[model samples]
Target: MMGESNRTTEIPCEFYSDKYPDPSNHPITIVLFTLLYTFVFLISFAGNMGVIYATIRHRSLQTVQNIFIVNLAISGVILACLSIPLTPVTHIAKQWFFGSLLCRVVGGTQAIGTFIGTFSLCAIAVDRYFRLVIAPGRPLRKVNAMRITMIMWAVSIVVTLPYVYHMNLMKYSPKHGLCGWFCTEKWPSPFSKRAYTIFVLVIQFLIPFSIMTVCYHAIFSFLRKRAKTRLTSIAQQANLLYVLAATAGRETQQHKEQMTHLLDQKKRVVAQKRRVTLILVSMVFIFGITSLPHNFVSTLMEFTDSRDLLTFYKTDYTYIVSLLTHLVGNEPDTTVAPFASLQPLHSFVNRYHSAVIPCANFETVFIWYINEYSGQFSSLAMLSCVTNPLLYAFLNPEFRELVLNGLAGVSWANNFVSKSWHPTQTTVL
Candidate 1:
């Protein structure tokens, strides 16, 4: 729906006509993208649900870091659910099929989706650094996580206000056409599209990205120092223990066994920590990859004149808008890619049950699940669906464990398929 003042026939409608064009759009491109879209949607759906499954089933995962992650996953799922089912149409018609209400829904969703996807990572970075540097002993409590999540949602809604309220559907020449679904601003002003675009890219993207870099750098440094110190302490203790045991004259096999058990346990903890760290680093790289293009194009778009901006928006070159439109908004796929890659974590989650998940808090999880399952949006929705749970399930270890346990409790089908089979004997050995 076109919002605000509708000047009839003022703008050329050559590109779009009074009558619907016969299906001349390339089927091959649509078919290929449809496949890509379906593939991405399915991944995102499973990923976000997995995140929800993990978080709710395990109390240990209910920390502020993970709650925030669930929030991101919820947003991604919402975006995906709203967007994916409509993919074929978007591929075929190059137009919005749903009514004005859905158009605004799509528009508002795209805005919220991107904000949460990018903003959640921003929040995670801040929270992570806060924990690492400020208070390693104290986790961000659940109450505080709720507070932060509420604020984030509030702000996201506020940011999306322009689209949610300002949008209107236009009935052009006896033909009803839904225009401007993907973060498209209908009414033009002094800044027109530029102001909103700048707000989205600079404030939402550039600002957060800057913060993330600093936080990660600090976290990385802290982890390095901590690891070295731990190694040193272990080495010193080993030497001392060896010397003391020798002095005792007779070494008990039980003592040796106990010491071996302790070392093995310590090794597991270190490995677990390393796995989480790997997730964080992977997120950093992907975040940069997915977001940098949009930000770069945004920066260029902001500086250049209308013609250039329109060209950039319309051309779909590099499929930048489509990438943002479909990829980042969906946070599940973002995390799921990593989850799928990390077989150990995925295998564990596969066994977990959804029923054991805290029913009280599953609205958000349901929100995520529905979004991914209903995938009906253009590529924009896909982008918003993919990013969140990646950070949750991978970057944060406890959340990963929670997701594992939750899956074990519910989703009987998934539980069996993921966990029924034994790992390869080689790995067990």
Candidate 2:
């Protein structure tokens, strides 16, 4: 198998591409990129940690929605610390410096974090849809919430196992010179890689996105119907003739108070529903928008012809020679000078690299784009991580109150907000 798989000995073509920034030659590019990624990591870490701490410390914020929020925060924290931070290093470095083991670990952790986050958002959407539309007045139990959260994490891990299984750490050969360490999949076949790409794109993203869309639409429809019904019922009740003498003294006073309480309760429920819906919708929107391009590009790449996409360089003769002599079982043409810059090396690598290993499909324009913009997209996605805590704080008054009250103990500055505060039950807008 090792002899059969020797085709990876081809010189690394990526380093020769003008698309990637040469940090050695352009040091400022590395600095700017590093600063950006570092900012994302710090902000994401702090925001997610704040959310987890706030959710756990506040009794009023322990609803099922908050549970999902906390779980997603955990995922975000992992992304910030484990997965996301590594992106800067990859972007600046000449090649994948990490060994095969760390490669799998990092790649797998990233996949896990992404899947869990995406699914957690979907779960929140589903929960809201059910609560407001399907099972109004029935609260989700803590036990059941815990069960669902566990299931989400479990499924995410299982679904992303391919990232770990196929990831290989490749070292640059002497002939390849300074290509450095790179991690890529060594899939057994091109079809397998394409299948997996499509599978992940569809299952993890497209399906969840569709589900959220449908759930939100249904929830909105239900809310609109209820609003219209309530307005109509109020108009009808107002039109009904009622004699003032019918319910004279004591009973009338008690009835008026009872009606007031009921109206206030209904108002509170409606406000809470609206606020919760808004928060979830915002989350779904941000996630869907930021993640859509990456998934679409990846899925689209599966259909692209890698032969036409890769750029060949003068240094790729080792790969071309090995391909023609070993795999093609053809005599080397003495007419062509060795190591001469040629275009056919690109074709040779694309044609037979898959036969040698599983991950040849990664050599495409899509992968090139991903490598180039990885930091940018990662930063974009992590922007959502920080925004989530802020969203909850703004949307849920109870959460905002808790955060403020927690801030109230520090100094005169803290006391200022504390003085202005009055405790109130959770009321949604």
Q: RMSD, each candidate, Å?
A: 13.9, 11.9
Task: Give the worst 10-residue stretch by lDDT in candidate 1.
Answer: 337-346
The C-alpha TM-scores of every prediction are: 0.64, 0.68
Tens digits of per-residue lDDT, candidate 2, 1-429, equal 787678765544444323333322256645655565566567777778877877889787888888988888887786667644454344334345566667677667666777777787788778877887778789688899999999998998887776467666654333433344455555677777657656776776688899888887787677667665765665454333133325453346655665566566556546645654675567668767656644553344335534322234622232222222211111011111111101111111111123223122334423333222211222235556667667644345556655655645456535544453333222221
User: Alpha-carbon error at 157 in model 2, in Å?
Assistant: 1.5
Task: Give candidate 1 regions above 4 Å deviation.
Answer: 1-24, 53-60, 165-184, 238-277, 305-387, 394-429
- Residue 316 CA displacement from its true place in model 2, Å: 18
Give the per-residue lDDT digits (tens) of candidate 1, residues 1-429: 354346554454322212223222445655666677677778777788788767676666666777767777876676566556553444244334476666566656655765776677788888888887778787778787788778887888887776455454432222222222211123444344445545655666578878988887787777767766776776676676678788998677865875686586467547645754665576577676655643554344234323222124334222223323444433211101100001011011011111122113324223222211111111222453555555456434344434554556566634434442332211110
lDDT scores of the candidates, listed in order: 0.49, 0.53
- As a whole number from 0 to 100, the lDDT of residue 197 in candidate 1 is 48
In candidate 1, position 75 carries an lDDT of 67
